[model samples]
Target: MTPQLLIFDVNETLLDLSPMKEGITKLLGNPNAYEDWFSILIQMAMVETLTDKYSDFGEIGAAALTMTSQKHSKSISEEDLKLTLHLIKELKPHPEVKEALEKLKSKGFRLVALTNGGRETLEQQMNYSGLESLFDGFYSVESVRKFKPHPDAYHHVLKKEKTSPEESMLVAAHAWDIAGAQQLGMQTAFIKRPGKFPYPKGKKPPLICKDFTELYMKLTVDA
Candidate 1:
């Protein structure tokens, strides 16, 4: 089926977060802190899903921060935690992200954001990127309190978009996100950005391109 809609993974896909790696290392302790924090965040998010609990993304963020800090015998002020979350909302988009989304939107596919961020943070990030106006709607895992890799997160997006998995495309830079979406029967497109991954969880994306510009060419969008 021709795709009528495209749902984007928000974090590493649209935003460039290489800076955060440094920020967290200095602030938290380990250079690999982002990965550690992110892993725990996902674990907690999934825990919420497994136990039928739902919390805002911000709450999950705070809990994850507290847990990680406590485990490492480090300290993080509440203000610093707020600042870190704010950084996410204020992140800059990837250099090519806006142009890519513009090209995709002009081709008549409805664009939506599917993220693990809270709705408010997602909105702020979108507006900061100046790509907010291009998106038709935003959906987040906050709706289901589950992080990526959980089928419910992807399923929630599919249901809200009112399209079958086959009729929609999931475009992401994270292989795990791609995997989860694919498991929900959604067609996927991978944008192979540096530091991103592409190994599939179940099958794989039907198309993988170096960037959205190449993706546009494959879709044959008239310039």
Candidate 2:
């Protein structure tokens, strides 16, 4: 069934992270450093949720960068770290993102963003990408003090929107996010961005498209 509400994941899904990747590559002199750092950042965020500790996503990112730098026998000054983190707010949407979002909106789906980033950061990201007006609402996991892949985050969005799990579909590039939403009985669409793959052990999403354009087609024409 087609969903009444379409929940989207930001960061690497809708917004491209290549700019941030370039910054990390310049800083660490390794083209792969950005992927390593991002992986660690997600791990650390889940650590906080599991340990019952709370830290803003930005703080966790900084800490992860520090740890990653230390692991590579490099030291990142506070000023440099802060500057790099600021690049997140300046991310641009993927090439097809705006058009696909417009297509979805024109079809009358209620679009919302549910991210692990803080409210202010998400706001900046949406505005910078010029997609802020496309969404009906923006939500952050900060409200529940938990990150994505946690059941609470998905439940909170469902409750706030007053939409049942079956009536909503989550669109994300990450396997973990899709798995979490699946556990809550929500439909899911996975966008296969470059180098990203779904977890082998998780339930496969019903819709797996190459990009936002393909996803839009699958949802609108094929569904």
Please report the candidate that would top TM-score against the real structure. 2
Question: What are the per-residue Cα lDDT tens digits for candidate 1 across 115-192?
Answer: 888888888888887888999999988787677778988888788878898999888987878888888888899999
Q: By summed lDDT, which 10 consecutive residues of candidate 1 come out lowest? A: 214-223
Top-scoring candidate (lDDT)? 2
lDDT for each residue of candidate 2 in 75-193, tens digit (9 for 90 to 100): 77888889998999999999999999999999989999999999999999999999999999999999999998999999999999999999999999999899999999999999999
**Candidate 1: where is the Cα deviation over 4 Å?**
221-223
* lDDT (0 to 1) per candidate: 0.80, 0.93
TM for every model, in the order presented, reads 0.87, 0.98
